[model samples]
Target: MSETNDTGTAAPAPVSNWNVPNALTTLRIVMVPFYGWALLVDGGDSVAWRCVAWFIFGVAMITDKVDGDIARKRNLITNFGKIADPIADKAITGMAFIGLAIIIDTWWMWAITVVVLVREWTVTLLRLSILKRVVVPAAQSGKVKTAAQAVGLGLLTLPLLEVDGWLDVPGEVVYGFALVILGIAVVLTITSGYEFFREVWRQRHEIREKSPERRK
Candidate 1:
């Protein structure tokens, strides 16, 4: 699901301040390829590729912030963004985590990666199903999940931050810390996903009760 701008106006001009949010989204989309290249084609573990991947990851993270700010400040939040933004985020984070899991040879990393991806994928369908009955707004827990995922992903990418002639932390500590935090993040991610689904169900039931068609 991609993040959408909620500019409520029905007939927004083709070019508006809203462009900032879309531009940032586009930037993130563009970075995915470069990030993939840095990891797969360029020898992700090497210093040169590490810098490229790190930069791409950093920029992707930054755009997550930038797009939100632009949407809220400009009142350009749209349903499209609400849907696409999260999808875009999942795609990028999923790639990074999966790549690291493969490279590091950690089975737990893959497990966490799968858990996170499942949460993301599940919520989209869950929300869509509930949207038929009631409007489902983003919840606080959902936001927290996104933040946690970002932190976990950033930490996981530390190995890719390696640079020649630069100090590298001991592998044990880095992976250990990342694993712990990612585990916590996965817990939160799943919990939030469940909560979101519960909220949707409750709202949908409420809507049904109020609808006259239900009386028949």
Candidate 2:
């Protein structure tokens, strides 16, 4: 993990997984089960529990952003962070999708959850598997997808439209907005996934074509 500095002297210190950023990532992963439990309490009907779940989801999302920023800023990136960070992100959102599908019991919810999760995890696993071999940069579609997914899922994780009270009309409006954003996120997921695989294949193929043996 150590890398040589200028002049080909001794190597710089290796970045450790035991750092603040990775700690936050680990904390986010640990929050996933609690968030799910709170979300599912009373079949996702309890206002207090849903609020708790939303708070936890928000914290997890914030930590996701923070951990990446801190890691890059402090040069604390590690294999653990590379693997666990994505897993943590997917776990929270994946649980959100699954939990919402169960509570809503809508055909579309179930369908989108299946499609999106399959695409997400497949792309994630592929990226991780080729981390050191093929370098596929993040696409704009992927960034948009993450933001839309986070906002949509965060809004939906609340008891907004599902609970009846003073917030009913506004809640419905927000819920509708969330659905629209979630729909866009789903489309972006598929498109970005395709772009990712295509780029990975292109990079690997180019590497092979330029190799000494292949040239010979």
Candidate 3:
């Protein structure tokens, strides 16, 4: 099957899902539950458990980077990757945020997590709604936000306070840095969300102007 291009020529065939990128995405999804279990099962108190959870989260995040780079460089881009990749990313990161908030039991942390989650899912829904009509590429801000979230959450996930004696660093200082990074991520999330909606509006307007009724 083929799609018609603007010139009425057949577009290139869709890439298969059997590629390495999709496999890595699937692996990331599969790791989500294990990461959560390791994170929350012990109330994130045990140093060993926290370390395990951090390792799992780190591996998943690395897969996120590897898969996307492989997909783009190898020309393995596909509709499934475009859709599922973000979902997988959000799943892992969202779990980390919520789990950490629960473990930490801080009102502000929970609030920040809730705000970020809402924005992420809202933008994801909007993108899906217009996906067929408009291709919303990931913006640089979005990428930076993801990176910030990963680093912030990774730091928070570790039993840093527990290892403060070993590392000779104050836990408070590390925690402060993590919160600052996450705060930046929240700001980026809101700004990038606005950009997404702006693009959607522009695309819809273009589509309406091209409609036969309007052209008539």
What TM-score does candidate 1 get on C-alpha atoms? Answer: 0.80
- How would the candidate models be sorted by lDDT, starting from the highest? 2, 3, 1
Candidate 2: residue pairs that collide = none
Instruction: Give the candidate number with the greatest lDDT.
Output: 2
Question: Could you give candidate 3's per-residue lDDT for residues 1-216 as a string of tens digits?
Answer: 789999999998878989999999999999999999998876787888888999999999999989989998999998888788889988998899889999889898899899999999888877766468888788999889988989999989988776646564777688789989988998999899889889988988999999999988
How many Å off is the CA of 61 in candidate 3? 1.2
1-216 in candidate 2: lDDT tens per residue?
Answer: 557779887786877778999999999999999999999998999999999999999999999999999999988999999999999999999999999999999999999999999998988898788557888888999999999999999999999867777889999999999999999999999899989889988988899999999988
lDDT of each: 0.72, 0.92, 0.88
lDDT of 1 by residue, 108-210 (tens): 7678778877878777766555476566687787777777777766766655245323345465466567677677778888888887778878987888898
List TM-score per model, in order. 0.80, 0.94, 0.88
Residue 113 miss distance in model 3 (angstroms) = 1.2
Deviation in Å, model 1, residue 185 alpha carbon: 0.8
Whose TM-score is higher: candidate 2's or candidate 3's? 2
